[model samples]
Target: MYIEVGQYLGQDGVWLKNDETRLFIQAFGGMTPEFSRKMRSQTRDYWLNAHWMPHFKAPFSGRMDNDDPEQRAYWQVELLRQAAGTFPCAPAFGPGTDNIPTHGDTANNVWSLASARLVDSGGESYAKAVWHLAGEFELLKYQKTDYLRQGDSSHYMVMTVENNHDDAVPINMAWHTTLGSPFVERGCWLLDNCQQYQVCPQGTEFDTTASLELGARFESLSDIPTRTGGKSDLSLMPGYNGHADFISGVSSSRQLLWSACYNPYYNLVYVSVIPLAQLEDQVSPSFMNYWIHSGGREMMPWADYDGGCDRNYALGLECAIGGSCKGYEWSRENPQLLNKPTYFELAGNSTASFVCINSFFSPEGYGRPITGESQLTEMIEQHIRSLDISFDGLQAR
Candidate 1:
């Protein structure tokens, strides 16, 4: 299987990678022609965009060249020669919370004019496809379904949102994902196991199984522990959420649960699998939620070879619908964040199904994340069931 969608750097993205590992598992963003505004690039393509991360934090912070320390070493050596995955959650998927959300929830309309049509991968994966995005969702005929496949090392996503509109649509899904682990240098953790756990802004609680690292571990920028601990917590420990202030923690398991973000001395991992009752909407009650982008420049430089060191650092994830879901009428008025947001409902015309699993690991397979011996999140679900990229009758344009 050798999959390729079209137009890289120019935007409308999708690429699987094989011509001897081009090193992309999923990709998007075409440099010009308005680039669909999906990740809302501008500010000079957010300083030459390529997953630059919806303006590097919060309603698009855009750091106006952060006091030109040589343009932050020329934009961290051009974001390691062009971003794709480390922009992480600019708008890859939304409704997790930027506060005034709910327009496609975020990511510039959840990847606005984005389009991918490989369909017929129902033929069995080389990169089966069906990706379209355009959701305002007020009246309710909105659309955004991303059904993709390509396994054998994993990448299977099925994000469906169909309202068809008879009226009754207020679900704020989430996948505001992010991971550019490269060499996370022994930081980033979350695996408090789960039957239910909530580790946010210091509202601590666990039931056993813990490994929660990362609340700011810069490695450079003078190793930012919130600038030599002058207060402002940066949060991972030591009292929880602070860096810029925005912390989220969740863990719930009725079985089929997972929420990972690992870099244990650079073993590398990014696994997300949670069936969560086929992803909520039996009328609310979803699970999984781990968001912490830590405001005010925690780590926003990509690495300019030693003198500046590699950058494009990142951290953000959402097993989502795990609630208190930060807004949208306050996650629809709490009831425990509306039973924790993973939303699931279609039955007016028909169509309601959900599944999730996103994987990317490196046990010296050369994707980075070195120094391994297994147990880095259990080898990322053993390469996500050995890339078992099977779609199993997925349909919903």
Candidate 2:
């Protein structure tokens, strides 16, 4: 039952045949322009063209950087590095060049797949697999119980790094997802738990404030927890709420169901030679634990698209082993800058997980955050099972 979802980068992104039974659903090429409007209507349950994203080159458009004939092509091509430009709804996991890899073959540079499966000696599907682009990126692969409901009974998705590159290069990354129209055109909102956030201006003239809002530096899982004041940080819970109220969407106002982003382990080295470096202490890998970072589970509003919907029709759930932004890197020689984010070589045997859960709810009762490590993990697994059952019902048709 494979179908054509949409197009991307002049290519095609097709929906897989067994997507209903697969852990995840991924489209290839670029997200089509018609996706936004279609998603709002219940006349159709699933949308092959359910998402859309603007080209990343818009930020550098008509600038002197585009003046040079060679540079123009470079920027044009490198722009795809931002996953948002290609897939309207996609997450940036792991690490590597924030700007698309201008040095590599831009055609194959983007590898956004829904889910992967590994086979055993008998060639039977053994364990499910998710994508981890390049060695620089590091994300945990887990299931999204609360957000999407479709596809498989073991329905799950976790952003992780595949470490498929040979070069050692600096990298910056985050999940970039542009929900389909009606969601974007009508505008969506966000609710996040992070306490501190910086307006990331990627050299764009457009008022980014309208497009994004960040949370303050968070200290723990709950709204209140042991504040992290010392060098060492503890792995806290993951969750957040939308500020003010839910954003209105075209069809119905939506809210974050459940979200979690945690990296339990990290590989780091704080260089001491750099006198003015902020991270003068030893770069203990423990600090990079997903449970320790500021933004765990969050609910945010997107004032950028359509008008301004607080429901967060489209959301970008992110988790990283290292700081995505440069200034936050505690170590002078930030390990996240490397193409190979860690030496773990997350091949067939490494164990890591990145989980984001979103459940739709009425404006009345708000969602809660998950704190205890064991408890949160268990809850997520249960939600994954629930989603599987729901998807099965849809597939029975």
Candidate 3:
């Protein structure tokens, strides 16, 4: 395995690779350093007077006053756009009505790389990278380590948070794993062990044509009830529908929790897994949050009057401790949001850690939904065996 340090957008990040697969992990925000530098170097009045300012909708609209708090908050959050790949959302995770940015401060700030190395153990080679970041409140410390075995497609991650304050602090964390085109397109299917799902009403403003009723609960994603008295097939991705939606689900089976996105057209599948038995301190994720952004936001960056861009086409399969991406406060206030606890508290001067495994596979034929633990394991083993054969052929040549 090889580890390369670089920047994705403007945030510090790293890439892990072997013979068949390559994975990129970056700090939360998406803007390039140069872009961020330019924005920060300019005066606030410059952006206020700029044409782009008018494209922002309500709450941010008609607020020409430089002293307006809403306008200031909007500008601050805009700088944090473009967070890509797999990143951690900590302390607070999700979209809230509050002024905070989506996914909280951790997702908006840059993280520093602490170390990267390769280790050989038990006749296997593993590559690891450690990253560290401080909370905005400076009350907690966060560390995330990524591990990938040589010639393997699976990427393993462990994230830990330590409370520095003498008093316990509430924490909400999630692994925001995202996939974009050409890996994500129409006909891609989302398969999971989730037994029930609830529609989240937080980001409805991004799409005017959203049909799914807020707070609605359903069993299967293929036949979710919509406001139009119709059932939308969420199993497959929709084409240029100009609608965005958020849904949260829980797995009734406590053995292994997993979700997968399979693109039949490409015969490729991406799976995220968490073994319930391996979790400690009862910090197991309570739900899975799936976000479908199919060219829904017609705002600036996403769209402009002059040949706007298609800033959609991404799916987020997040394993979260919270019910939805809504902030901790909101989840606490509305305990009914989910039957399980929305957030967990980390004891003072103590630490809690979570583990997750994400794997990719390219089968020889059409791919199908991953339904159980044994199937997923066999698929991964098959992929590894194929890699070994290919490597042997190359050496023989």
Candidate 4:
């Protein structure tokens, strides 16, 4: 395995690569220079800015004039929607603290590289690195370790959060993995083991053209209810049709949770796997959040209606441990629908860890979906065995 370190959107990031594929891990912000410029070009009068911009005196700051607790809370919830990360990134949402930034301190602050090196075990080589970041209030610390093996496409990651306070604290976090461009074309299919799904109640606020029904429930992603009394085949990514939608669901398999995006045109698939049983007890009720942006947002950075760019075509397959991306309060209030607790309590002076694998590979056949837990596990095992990598603890159930 080879490692390349650099800065991504002003935050420390690293790229882990082998002969087969590569994966990038970075701090929350994944904005490109062009995207940043376009974000800055939006007028203050736009609905997005008008509703929340006045609350913050500066970018990514808590300084605000509003004394009302409700207004302040609204600001925190809206921050990530306005400015979020792209590609594979971690965005830690609440324990619902006012002092913390929108996506917690980890998302807003830059992380420092603690260590990086290559290890040789059983004649097999792999790369490992540790990255750390401290919260603004210094109450919690974030650490992430990445493992990439030679000649393997899969990248394994372990993320830990330590509570510095004397008392226990609640935490909510997720991996905001995104796919775009050639990999997410018109015919791409989203394959998952989720048994149920609920449409996001909060639709894209700036997207006036959005058509998905809020709070709708479905049994599969392939057939989702729409606002127009029609069923949408969400499994297949459609052409730019000026629409956007969000949905959240839970996988039926608790042992191994997985989702794959298969692009028939490229004969490639990007898979994200989370071994839920391997994670700490503090992380429970794992959920998958799917966000589709197809030229619906007409504000500032996503002015798709203006026709200069088609930057809004992307899919976010976020693997989360709490209630979708909703903050702590919303998650707590809406637990009945999800049938699981949206937040977990972490003991003081203790650390809770979560693990996941993100990989990119070309499948043997065209347009064949990787279905069921057994098949997914077999594919991962085969890939690892082919690389001659011995990952003992992560065996398939």
Candidate 5:
């Protein structure tokens, strides 16, 4: 493997490539610009004054005057929030989650911070990155007004999290996993042990042909429905809903599981696997979520909505923890609903962990690796070990 340690949008980043594919890893891997410029032109958090992060901010849409400085600035905040809900940032093959540390109740530092280093030996290369709550930097854009006891937190385990649905409690850790927008398009498809499940509409205005249950036989991208809605659809609403009207659910077995997607556009297939054995695993997500985005709506926020994969669209296959991105409280409350562990903890950390792998299958793999799910599965089983991957510095035994 060949590695390039460089800067992405002024943030530290590493680029990796071999004969088959190329992938970018960042210190701030999952950070997205506060707003959308061109969906295709989005780099990993490199803008000068842009606030890129994975935040749970409110979403907004509709026409705004670009010429009006005040309106533009105000919309920028909303756009960033909307972008956070719509796009996944970077690919960090380690332990991280969405239950961010907050100053008080709801005040959170949207940007998840980390420092990543490249590890390479022989012909194999991987990333070794340490994740942390932002300490030295001013975490929030503004300060807390109320009496602060803990001051500002750099870790959620050190903070208090609460919801009306669940009790307010001292939280320790959560299961957090997500893959951003780069993994979608024509030949891009997710292979999982999915047999019938649920589909909950995340945003207020979401339109999907998806039934409450899905079959295991997904052979083509077109086999899936067009997730984008038209004029009133959230996908076309220009960052209006941060959650992006996503639909998700667990397997029929309803156990912690894994899923893999093939990205022909990138000449590789990405896998997101999760572990949900411990009750301390606060957040438990559905095995997968298919997030839809309209590149046309993103580019022209003021223009009319364009549904489907018109210009630039993304189909994200998410493997979430903490109740499918609901966070610690939700997972803790719903432990009885999840599958018990068939395997022991693989990492040394008390926090959530999993194995995420990506492999390059040449476009010319033809029927061998590209045609059938069994062929691809065997290929992954064979090559995944040679890659030498780890989630929390603990190698797979």
Candidate 6:
């Protein structure tokens, strides 16, 4: 077990050890176990057990019996058989559904409050280093905020990685999170303020297209001002309606944030974030990042979810910044072969920001209708400026 206290952020968090084992995050006041075993088991079975058949494995199994339906059917059956238990199946995995590889061999760093105690949740109480990559990149800085009206409760987990080599580097990153018991059940409701959707290749199974406009289109719009205070079961918007994929810019910039939110009072979970890229299209070694909030007496504010889960009395707000180990360079040079990597280079080092706030209810109760994009963008920019000012103040301290 490793205990790390991010004093500058004014909060504490934890982390668990091992690249292929369990991880528990307490910064957001939630605990979850890693399901890599199941992920790996399914991935391995897909590759070795499926026997690609007519597709062939080259030197080992060269296109055996091209016209054999028995062989093709066998391959199809094997694919479906393996998919029975695999997650993110078609919409998230695409043609590589059964054979999709794990994001990395393991999970990456998840940002939260002051100190994250990476520990063993299985009663071991082991404390591990929250920044296992500390040797590679020092905690350049940490920032905290109480944007959710939780009275110093909300937190923003930020870590800046500088190029140690004194030279420019390319990287791709994604925030992969696993939530424990009590996940969102099927037929539950979800809501999003995204005016547009960016369909990733992987999400094509759910909905092949994407959009960029949002407005008043809820099956039941309430005047509630927060998620916790609002009614359950919201409707999908006209067009761009599906699960496992969300409005692209939701967690980044001012467009969108948190991938999903839950009405714990009603036991109804809502996932509003989706994969922005596909497994086959993803560039190697990208970094996934987002935010998290928990331990509140009522509904929590919105958080990001580039990866990870919002679960177990907690919400995991993940965002994919870039990659580690100069992997983004690989993506940059091979843009045609890579997934939808953010064009950070477009704005250079100007510092871009994305914000997701999970309120107990929408702003409708405040006498404001769901103005979607216009209101969302305004709020995001405000928060970003506030954080910048806060960071400036922290430096003075």
Give all candidate RMSDs, comma-separated: 21.2, 14.5, 10.5, 9.4, 12.1, 16.8
Q: What is the lDDT of candidate 2?
A: 0.27
Put down candidate 1 lDDT per residue, 1-397, tens digits, no spaces. 4445554433434554322222232232211111111111235221111122433222221222656676655444332223334222211123334432321332333244345444454455444444444444442333333333433333455555556656455455455445432322224554433433333322222111112332332222112233234433222212122222233444444545565655544444556664445433322225455444322233344222433322334454455553333433444555353234433334454434344555545555544443442355456555655554233434422
Q: Pick the candidate with the highest TM-score.
A: 3
**Which ranges in model 6 have alpha carbons more than 4 Å from their true place?**
1-132, 135-153, 177-183, 202-318, 322-330, 333-397
Candidate with best lDDT: 3
For residues 220-251, what per-residue lDDT tens digits would candidate 3 score against the true structure?
Answer: 89889887888899988787676778889898
Clashes of 6: 71
Tell me the TM-score of each prediction against the true structure: 0.29, 0.38, 0.77, 0.75, 0.49, 0.35
What TM-score quantifies how close candidate 6 is to the native fold? 0.35
lDDT of 4 by residue, 41-81 (tens): 24542110000111121243233345666444434333332
Candidate 5 lDDT tens digits, 272-314: 4433332342233344545444333322232223232323344
Model 6, 50-153: lDDT tens per residue? 00111111122123353777555433322221111011100011121122222221121233443343333323232322222221221222122211111111
Worst 10 residues of 1 by lDDT: 30-39
Q: Looking at model 6, report the run of 10 residues with the lowest lDDT sum.
A: 84-93
Point out the higher-scoring one by lDDT: 4 or 5: 4
Two-way TM-score contest, 1 vs 6, winner: 6
Give candidate 1's error at residue 90 in angstroms: 22
Between prediction 2 and prediction 3, the one with superior lDDT is 3
Candidate 3 matches the true fold with a TM-score of 0.77
Residue 329 error, candidate 1, Å: 6.3
Determine which window of 10 residues in candidate 3 has minimal summed lDDT.
45-54
